[model samples]
Target: MQKNKQWNVKGAMRLAGTFHFLHSCASGCLLPFLTLYFRHLGLTATMTGIIMASRHMLALVWRPISSVLARQHDKRRAVVVGSLFSSASVVLILLLFPSEGLKAESGRCNASQLNANVAEDGGEFTTLENLPQFNATVYSVYNTTVVTEQSNDDDTAEYTPTPLISNSTRSVRKVRSLQEEHPHSEFLGSLKVMDAQHQMFFLVLIVTGFWEFMAVPLEWTADDGLYEYLDFVDATDRHRSAKIWKQLGAAFGNGGVGILVTGLYCLTGTTAEFYSYAILMILTVPAAALLPLYLRKRERRTSGGFKALQLVHGNSQALLCAVTVVLTGMASSVVSDFLLWQMQDHNATETHMGISLALAHFSQVGFVPLAGRLARFLKYHGWLLVLAVIALSLQCLYYSFLWGPWTVIPAQLLAGISTGAMWWSVESQCEDIATPGTEKTMFRVFELLSLELGAGFGSLMAGFVVQKFGLSVLFQGTALILALWSIALALLKWKIPRQRRINYSRLLAADMTEMSESDSDQEKDWLETAMDDSKQKNKWTMDKPSK
Candidate 1:
C-alpha cells in the first residue's frame, strides 16, 4: 500500500510538472514578444493598448463560463487540452495577417538619401527642411545606382546605409513632410494610413480576443485540476514544487526564443516569434492531456458560481486580498504590455528583452521555495503580497529611468518577488479560504477574475496615457499608484486585528466524515431494497405453484 501510494504521488507530481512547464514555455515564447510584434507591424501604443485591453475584457466574460463548464461537467482536463489546441490555432491565424505596415516603409529611403548626399558632399549635406525634392530625386538616383552597380557585377552586392537622422530631427522631418506635401496628396496619403491602421487594429483585436478566450482558461483549470489531484493523494505540499519546473520552462523558452529571434533578425531582418509561439503551444497540448485531473463524480449542493464573491463579502481579509490583487494586476499589466515598448524606445534589442525575461523567470525558481518561509516569518500571507506590491512599484520606478537596454535587466530580477512570490501568496490564501467542493471555482473567480479585470482596465488607461504623456510618464504614474496602494494596504493591515486561521485539516476531516456516512446510508438502503425484492419474488413463486 505504501509503495502504491508513493508511486501515485511521484507519477502525479511528474505529470503536473510536465504540464505546467510546457504551458509556461508556450507563454514565455510568445507573451514577452507579443507587444514588440505589434510595434513591428506598425501599431501605435494606443492601438496596441486597445487590443490588449480588449483581450482581458473578453477574458472576464469567458473565464466564468469556462469555469462553470469545467466544474458542472467535471471536465477540467478536457477544457485544458481544448484551450491549448484552440490557442495554438489562433496563433497560426496571426501569421495569415499582413506583417508589413505602410508606415514602416515610408521612411525607408530617408537614411540612404542622407548618407549618399553626405558621402558625395564630403560630409556636408543640405538641411532636411529644404531637401524634400532633392531627397526624392536622390532616392531615385540611389536606387538606380544600386541596380546598375549590381547588374555590372557578376555577384549581386547589397548597399546598406546607417541612419544619420537624430531622433528630434527625424520627428521634425516627418511632421514637415506631412505638412509640406501637395494638399491633395497629403490628404490621400493620410487617408490611406488611417484606413490601414484601422484595418490592422480591428484584425489584431479580433485575433487577440479569440486567443485570450482560449489561453486564459488553461491556467485556472490546469491549476485547479492539479491541486485537486494533489489533495486527493495527500501530496498537496508538492504543488509549489511543481512551479519550480514551470519557472525553469519559462526561462528556457524566453532565453532560447529570444536568441533565435535575434539571430534570425540579424540574418533576415524579420523575426519568427509567432511561428515559434504556435509550435510551442501545439506541443503543450499533449502535455496537458497527461496531467492528473480529479473529477468529482457527484454534484455539490452549493453552486460554484459567485462563491468567490460570497467569500469576499463574508471575510474582511479576503476582500483586502482581492483588492490588493486588483491593484497589483493593474500595475503589472501596464509593465507587461508596454515595458518592452519602453525598452525598444531606448534602443533595446530583442536579445535584451529576452534575457531580461529569462533572468526574471530563473529567479522565480529560487523565490518559490522561499515564499512559504517568508510568509511564515511575516506571520501572514498578506504581508508577502504587500512586499510584492512594493517590489513591483520599485520596478516600475526603475523602468522610468532606464539609461540603456541593459538597465532593464536589474528590474527584471525583482519579478521573482513581484510576480512569482505574489502569486504564491495569493494562491495559498485562496486555498485556505476555499470550501471543499468549490476550490477551483473560487480560485478562478478570486484570483483570475480580479487580476484580469484590473489588467483590462489598466491596459485601457495605459494606452491613452502612453500616447499622451509618453512611456516615462506612464511608468512613473504606475509607480505612484502602486506605491500609494501598497502604503494603504500596509496601514490597513496594521489597523485591523488578524483573523484566526481556519483549521483546514479539521474541515477536511469533517467533510470526509460526512461523505463516508452518506455512503454508508446509501449502501444500507440498497441492501434493504434488494432484500425486500427477493422476498417479493419468493412470495410470487409460492402463489404460482398453487395455480
Candidate 2:
C-alpha cells in the first residue's frame, strides 16, 4: 500500500509537470512576438499601446467573472481546456485579417507613368514639341518637371531657348497634363487609403481584445486547480518543484521557436509563430484534461475580498509592498511591450530577440531555487524587493544607451533579479500576511489586480511617449521613475518601526492554532451526534416491552 501510494504521487507530479511545460511552450511561442506581428500589420506605436492596454484592462474584468462561473459550475478543468482551445482558435482568426493592403494599394498608385509615355513618343522630342497639345516647354530633371508656358503675346513672354534635352524629358509635357487633370482624385485616393488602414487597426484591436478575454483565465484556473490537488495529496511542498518545469518549458519553447522562426524567415520571408502557438496550445489540451481534480470541499466565503482589503489596510508593510508591485508591473510592461520593437529598430534579427528572452527565462529558473537564501542574506524580503527594483532601473538605463541589437542581450541577465526575485519576494511577503482562508483573495488583490492596473497604465503611457519622443526617451524616463520609486521604498523600510512590522512566525503559529481548533470542534460535533443516536435507540428498546 505504501509503494502504491508513492507511485500515485509520482504519477501526479509527472502529469502536472507535463501540463505546465506544454502550457508555457504555447505561451512562449507567440507572446514575445505579438508586438512585432502587430507592427507587421502596420500598427503605429500609439495604436499598439491602445490594443495592449485594452487587453490588460479587460482582463481585470474577465478574470473574476471567469473564476466565479468556473467555481459555481465546478468546471475548472473544462475552463482551462476550453480557454486554451479558444485562444488557439483566436490566433487562426487573426491570420485571416488583411495585412498591409492599404500600403500595397498606395504603392501601386504611386508607380511612375512617365516611362511608358516616353517609350510611346518614339524618342523624338521635336515631334512632341511641334504637336498642338504641347504649347508648354517642359524641362524635366530627375522626374521633376518645370513647365515654361508660352504666352500668346510673344513680345512680353521671356523664354530661354536651349538645346533639346535627351530622352530624360521626352514625356514631361504629357505627364504634367495627367497630373493637372487628376489632382483631386489623387488627394481623395490618399484619404481612402488612410481610412482603410484605420479600419484594419480597429478590426485587429477587437480580435486582440477577444483573445485576451479567452486567455486571462488560463493561468488562474490552472494554478489554483493544481495547488488544490497538491494540497489534497499532502504534497504541497512539491508545488515549487512543479513550477520549475514551467520555467524550463518556457525556456525551451522560446529558444526553440526563436531558432525555428529565424530559419523559416530566411528561407520563405514568413514566420511560423502563429502556427506554432496554435499547435502547442492544441497539444496542451490533453494534458490539461488529465490533470488531477481533487475538489477539496471549501466553504464559500463571501467576505474574502473584504478581508483581503482589511489585511492590506491594517498592515503598513503590506500596503507598501502592493505599491512596489504596481511599480514593478509598470516597469515590466514597458519592457515586454517595446523591447523587441526597439531591437527591431536597431536591426536585430528574430534570433537575437529569441535567444535573449530564453536567457531571461533561464535566469528565472536559476533564481527561483536561490530566492530563500537570497532573502535570508538580505535580512528581509523588503530589501530584496528594493534591490530588485534598483536592478530593473539599471537595466532600463542600459537599454536606453543601446548601440546595437546585440547590446540589449546583456541587459536581459538582470531579469533574474528584477523579475524573478522581485516577484518571489512580493509573493512571500503577501503570503506571510494573508489570513488563512483568504490566501487566494490576497493574491488576487496584491498580485493580479495591482499588476494588471500598472501594466495597463504603463502601456498607455509608453505608447504616447514613444510616439512623441522616441524609444530612447521612453526607456530613460522609465529608468528614472523606477530609481526614484526604489529610493522611496528604501526610505520607508528604514523609517518604519520593527515592532509595527509583520511577524511571520507569529502569523504561522496563529494559523496553525486556528486549524487545530477547527478540527477539534468538528470532532466534538461528530461525537455529540453519535451519542444522541445511541440514546434514541435505547429509549425505543425500553418502550418496546409495552408493545
Candidate 3:
C-alpha cells in the first residue's frame, strides 16, 4: 500500500496535468483584466499597450539577470518564490479588474468576506456554504476543497488553490461541518460539465506546447515526436491572415491571463488578498526547498552566490561572448527582416509578410521539440555554430540576391532550421564553459542581448544599407559578409573542444529555476522599472519614467 504515491501514465498525467494547469494558468491568465487595471490607474489604451510592450522589452534585460540570479541564488527556490510574486501581481492587477464584472458580481451571492481579503486561520478552504450569508444566487470564495476517494482524513488537497469560482445554484442553508471530509465525494461548487468544456477546448487550443515539453524526458531515449514536429513544421509557411490571427490570439491570450488572475482577486474583495497571492507565488514548492540554505546564507555563512561567469573554459574571456551574442542576434533579425524585405522588394503585399511572420509561430510550436535532433547531431558547439552560420548565410543569399519574394517560403523554413541549430550550438558551448550555478543567468543574458540587441542593430543596419548602397548592394554585400562569417563560425564550431556537454536535465533544471515569481513589490518594481527602461529604448530613451 504505497499511500500518497501512485505511478502510472494516468497518475503521471494527473500530476503533470496539474503542473500543466499551473504553468498555463500562470502564463496565459493575465490578459482578461490587466489593461482594465492599468486604465483604473488612469492610463489610456495606447498608453497601456506601450506599458505592456515595455514590460516585454524589459524582459529582454530581466530574463538574463533573473537567470543569473537563479544560478547564483537557488534555482528551485527562485522558481517557487518567483511564482509568489507572479501571484501577487495578479492580485494587485485584480484591484483594477473591470468594475463591470464587479458590478455584475454585486449582491449575487453570499460571498462571506466577499468584500473581505484574507480569511481567518484554522478556516482553510472555502465553499458556497462557507461564504458570507448573502443568500444570493452566486458564490465566489477561496479555499474550496474537492474531496475524492483518494483523499485522507487529514485532507491532503489543502494547499491546492483554485483560481476562480462561479456557481448558479443558491444554498438552502449553511452547513457548518468541522470540515467537509468524506470519501468518494467531490465538492462541486463549480460546473464540472461546463468547466470540462472550457478546459478541454482551451487545452486543445492552448496546450500545444505543453505536450511537447512533456516529451523532454524521452529525449534520452527514442524520440519520434521531435522528428515529426520538425519534418512537418520545417515545411510550413503561415502566409495567411488566419495564421497571423492565431498569433494575435496567442499574444492577446497571454495578456489576458494577467488580467483574469487579477479579476479573480478583485472578485474576492478581501484585504491583503492581493498580498497573499504574492505570498503564494513566492512560496511555490521549489522555493520552499531552499529555505535551509537561504537561512544559513542570511546569517552570512556563504550563500551559493558566484562573482564571476565563465566563457570558453575559464579562458578569462569576457565581452567576447557578449559581442558574439549581440552579433548573432543581429544576424537572426537580419534573417527575418531580409526575408520580409525581399517580399516587399518584389511588390508583395504587407499582408504576405504578416502572414509569413505568423507562420513563424506555427513553426515555433511545431519545431522546438524536434529541433533537439539537430542539437543531438551537432553535440559540439563549434559544429552547431557552423551549421547555423552556413544555414543563415545561404538563407540570406537565397532571399536577397537569387530568388524573389516567392523564395521567402523556403527562406523561412531554413531560418527555423538555423535558429534551431544555433540554439543547440550556443547552449552546448554555454554548458561546456559556464560557471556552476551561473549558467542560466549567463545564457539568459546571451539570448536576451543577442536577440534584442541584434534585432535593434540589424534593423538599423539593414535600413542604412538599403538607403546608402541601394537594395541590391545591401543584399549582396550582406550575403557576402554573412557567408564569410558563417565560414569562420563553421571553422570555430569544428575546432572547439568536444569536452563540453549540455545535458537535458541541466537545461530543464535551469528553466524550472525561474519558473516561479518574485515578491509582490519585487515583481511590480522590477516590471515597472523594466517598463521604464523599455520606454527609453524607443519613446523616452533619454529620460527615465517616474515611478
User: Which candidate number maximizes TM-score?
Assistant: 2
* lDDT of prediction 3: 0.42
Candidate structures ordered by TM-score, highest first: 2, 1, 3
| Candidate 1 lDDT over residue span 187-282, tens digit each | 544444343446677788888887888887787677877887788878777876876887888888888787887676634333467777778878
The C-alpha RMSD of each candidate to the native structure, in angstroms, is: 13.6, 12.7, 27.6
Residue 371 error, candidate 1, Å = 2.5
Ranking by lDDT: 2, 1, 3
lDDT (Cα atoms) of all candidates against the true structure: 0.72, 0.74, 0.42
Give the C-alpha lDDT of model 1: 0.72
How far residue 123's Cα lies from its native spot in candidate 1, in Å, is: 19
The TM-score that candidate 1 achieves is 0.72
TM-score of each: 0.72, 0.74, 0.40
lDDT of 2 by residue, 248-318 (tens): 88888888888887676634332488888899999998888888755535645343767788888888888
lDDT of 3 by residue, 32-102 (tens): 23333332233322333333333334444444444334434434344444444444453453353222111
lDDT preference between candidates 2 and 3, better one? 2
Model 1: weakest 10-residue lDDT segment is 121-130
